[model samples]
Target: MLFRIKSFFNLKTKAKYGLPLVLMALITSQTNAQDNRSFQIFQFPANKIPTIDGNSEDWKIVPENYIVGMDQLWDDSGKQPKADPKNLAVSVKIGWVKGLNRLYFLYEAYDDYWDFSLPGLHNDTFELIVDADQSGGPFIDRFHPNPNLTNTMDAYFSYHGVHAQNYHIFTPAVEKDWTMVWGSQPWIKNLPYANASYKYDFKPGQGGKLTLEFWITPFDYAGNNPSRAVESILEENKNIGLCWAIIDYDDVNKTENNGFWNLSKEHKMYGNASYSLPFKLMPLEKQYKKEIDAKWSFKVVNMAKREVAFVDESEGEITSWNWDFGDGTTSTEQNPIHQYKEAGKYVVILKIQGPKGISQLSKVWDVAVK
Candidate 1:
């Protein structure tokens, strides 16, 4: 139930009569119909969801496989300008998590300065361009006009003092003409289902670094609906196009500097291009099936009277545990203490349930009578 811009309302007539209630109802119903659509599946290796607090401690366990460096991006302005390495020498580590019907992003930007004073394209910002439908035709070109294109979406974010501002690009146009979906405040306070945080470094000598964490639904864009409600744009399409860029502004010369992580030279404009890399957002349940490998060790506390206590030191998310005391008796406690009537050589077995199904480990223990 994709709602094209033309089918919904006439842009010219919005000022005259505004959007009719009937048309609004139609768009909402179509968006709701997307619930039955299939979604792309992805399984993250970590179980703990990352907190969107501008701190990346939760991502320590995850691998930083996606690396976007400043050197890889092209100069769209064609100035052939040389930028200070101290400010431009930056890299970004990106990780994705899909949960609660929303997409989460963990971005770590390594830079020298964090500036947020300038306005429009002159400000230090992180930009994201996405093609929700992946229909390769009318791409987003900042310098060119392609009104026939409607699938691309763009977002520009900057941190200013205690709050952060997100500038959303409604159409495939240049940075100067792009409209701010959320108004007035320097911070993003009006977005319905979006949240983000950033940590900036102001210390000298050591390059400034920032950790940005945020989450948004696929339908959380201005083009989708005027209300900006949570919808399944990703689920409706299954595949999407994506690219990111880091913009740096030099206040001394009033010039713009840009760097990208995953964008191609042809599509290196300040907005999303229809002809870009494709990404599939899959369901977690389909990718969560695997056999768990059990690893554990134990410490035995002797009671000195044929009684001993066993402590479980295991890794991973263990749901249930089974312990065998070697004397034809068993217990379901994670760590259980067993007392034998007499001294003997016995084998202890531990069976645990984890993400990878069931696994067991065994060790030999000797008990002496006091």
Candidate 2:
């Protein structure tokens, strides 16, 4: 019995004391590895984007209902197209891969009408060229045969020219990837685009999956801020705060109204940077027993400094919130209303929780204080 007891004591001593030290060493090593994992954008090597079937390419000529040689100034009083070709568009797809470092992009480009000019004179060959690691930066140009000109076999003339440009600058903490494309070159001026996109194959030091896709719509060119209409659409949602949307405008706040909001630091399955209403409106236990059919209710109000409190009770346990100053700023706190010291429209958002999960609601209210 004494010999068995001695062996058990030795085993427990080693496990209770030595095991934790080993775990600590392993965790510290992992932390150090994560601290050193950082990356920057190396120029994507230029390649000839092959045209498999020119006629059956993914792009639709004169997309968004804008046609060639037509008097469509802007998509709908927003931004104009870039050049005189009627419309400029590119459609791309990539085959899925197992890792983030290596990949391929298949793209197709088209003009407004393919060849809007000569009747039965429909011989238009296209070319896709990427100018990467250039003197300044990377550029993608779509080449087209000039309708009025000809080549060796009496085909239309073709040349490579960029309709838009894409480049990225990375800071140690924040990665800035930007793509600028125009709606119409000279015909419409207001709405040049900040491509609504980013590369999702990011290495956050940990092996994980990040994927994104964008839908680009070319609207009629509004002189210089074609994104104004898109902004208005976002404004309706009022989730524009802490976000950006790029266009040919000089507004600072409006700059972030476009692309995907990066939330990698949150360490969630899918990262998102958004606000939440963390309170609950529940019936008292006694009230619940007595009046099972009686409904429970609550309010949310905004009391932040120099901000207005606007409340929406269209849904959820959060019934109403007060706006102390009728300004666009708001909060999800019970009975919240606020007053602003300045005059301007503001974007407001709300979060509500239910038995299933949490949800977000947003709206933009224009407030002019007298």
Candidate 3:
């Protein structure tokens, strides 16, 4: 089942009739807090949990924040002045979702043609290069003269005709030579957890689109059993290095163009210094906590009979203060004393502005007439 974290700033208000609705909108916009040595990949929270059946319907509700364009490919030899016309015409949208303990991805590509007859990387394929540890150290370079597994994991999906196959390239800790692991494994699958169906569509004319979805667990390069439990990896690291690319075979036996998207300027055969981007994986609970903790704290004290003093205990710098005293009255003072004409219980809300963004707090105070 899909779980959603409610917005911390959206507080339920209890207001009497004929009063303007007291809306305290605390917008907590998250900035990329991780190191920005390379491009920072934002893992947007999924709204409509995708079924991973390759259908594009579920993705319709996802916000534009989760979508990025992969319309051009980097010239590896530095010979081509720009991405070839055959490749430039292709548009790719990449979406990411974090579920339970697994990471999900949806790759949608719009191309004029789709070729699956060629073998290996030469065919229509999607390559995912990941640095699970984000160590930024030595890794297995696919283009290296002696390519052996180091600290990188490469997953390749080749679509030929009606058949599709999955392949993984990594160097096992026990082995010195780089090993090419193929077929379905426990760690990786074409569908989300192998239970969902893979979706695909092809049109003969222009504006053809292809969509694919997959998921992966956490993997450790140094361990004997490299694939570790998702919980362990989450506990150890909050970010992972990732990059993706799409290979297009425009003509029947010729590799026409390669289009790259997100992370990296040049397509690194295995892993490149420019290829990996630090992707911050925020779980739902952590996200909620971060939003709630960013708020300010204030308390209400009975200054006198039928009167109360709102004390602002917020630290650091505050830009603005907005208070709604529930009795059709409001205040913008940092600390304001409000009086009640009649004995009753009222809900007091305070909205404060800070460096991170707006935050809110509320309390119910009882006023007694003298």
Candidate 4:
């Protein structure tokens, strides 16, 4: 009972329509076909897929609504300006349903061509930031898929030289429930730091995709001095994809590193897997609404004299505030203060919550004994 009433609708067109009736027809017909046949998976080389659409650069859909495509990780503009590197890839492609919020993302990240080129151990990083209605969202861990941490598919090294522990930083937000998602930022191992990687699934549509964009940046080392490397990567590769782009630096001049030749000639490893971003709409939404800026401001006074003893009623959005008057306990309030029981260097901390999120400030006060 194979009814091949094929018309002229493309995958992109079908996704755009997103009709319930159309979806039912697709599920019914496709499921029927699969039930009669044996299935096999086509494992591809690490760097590229097997085919491309003859009609367009767009990916063609397979029998199971499976569509995949790869481009040499382009610059911000989603245009391939260079050839795919043997040791690493700088491009990404994603396939998902129309109107659905969640989509699976396959990201390819690579670095220099050293013998130690291992996944998650290179000097490269990928970060995805989602903006909705022009506002920031909560900090979602884009690296881990589940609490079990079993699915470490986000990043993979070519040979095996990756190393690093994962960490999280808290921030403030104004847009309420705005999601700021990004992969781990790593340190480059060497000139041919070689290959590194990271990946994760995402909840989209619940927040709209128009405002979501990726910032492909490179940093020398993690520090406070506004690392020079960030600006360097941005200026050099601004032409990379904005919605989704491969963050590659070595191929800036569109030339592969000489070291790649040595690996190809000596190791008998000419082919590798290209990065693929196959997005799927996940039926999930965030559990908690984003908190106000971690920083907050309020007034503090002395109860005995009715005098404004410590007028900490500062003017600003304080998401979180901690006051320690040489005391062991701490309080997180808009405005907080402690009375001087004895004289000592009392440390005061104010975790300010603003549009940019949370920041902690500490000041030492010399409380004197009268």
TM-scores of all models?
Answer: 0.47, 0.19, 0.47, 0.20
Query: Which residues of candidate 2, in runs, are more than 4 Å off?
Result: 1-214, 217-221, 224-307, 310-335, 339-370
lDDT of 3 by residue, 1-370 (tens): 0111133222353223222332321111111123244332234455546665667676564445445454334545444456544543333333344434555565666566665533344445555565556545323323333334322243211111001112332101112111122322333432333332333455322235555654554333322222432221542227666665555445655555533333354344334423466566543434423432223234345534567776776544678788888788999988888887666777778888867677777766533334
Question: How would you order the candidates by TM-score, starting with the best?
Answer: 1, 3, 4, 2
**Winner by lDDT:** 1
Give candidate 2's whole-model lDDT: 0.27
* Model 1 steric clash pairs: 40-281, 40-282, 40-283, 41-282, 41-283, 42-282, 291-356, 292-356
Clashing residue pairs for model 3: 53-197, 53-199, 54-199
State candidate 4's TM-score.
0.20
Ranking by lDDT: 1, 3, 4, 2
Number of backbone collisions per candidate: 8, 44, 3, 58
User: Candidate 1, residues 1-370: lDDT per residue as tens digits?
Assistant: 3355456555665666566754675666664333232223243544667777878786564433344555555544554354446656544443445435455666665555444443454545556654444533432322224433223233111111011112442111223332243322222223455666667655322346666666654432333233433244545226665555555543424454543323344433334343345556643433353445454454446646566676665555788888887889988887677787767777888788977578887877643334
Query: Any runs in candidate 1 off by more than 4 Å, and if so which?
Result: 1-47, 78-85, 93-99, 119-121, 136-191, 203-207, 220-224, 227-230, 233-238, 252-262, 267-272, 282-370
C-alpha positional error of residue 3 in candidate 3 after TM-score superposition, expressed in Å: 52
What is candidate 2's CA lDDT for residue 347?
A: 48
- On residues 1-370, what C-alpha lDDT tens digit does candidate 4 reach at each position? 3234234335565677666656676676565344321111122221323222112122222223232213312232223344444534433333322222212233333334312122221212233321111111112233222444323433322111111111111011122212121223333311221122222222211111111111122232212222322221212101111122222323323333222211011111111101111122221112212333232232335435322123343334544455554447566544444554544455555555566455554555533232
Per-candidate Cα lDDT values, in order, are: 0.50, 0.27, 0.45, 0.28
Which residue ranges in model 3 land beyond 4 Å of their true spot?
A: 1-47, 71-73, 77-80, 83-99, 141-187, 190-198, 203-207, 222-232, 235-237, 255-262, 272-274, 282-370
**Candidate 1 local Cα displacement, residue 281, angstroms:** 3.7
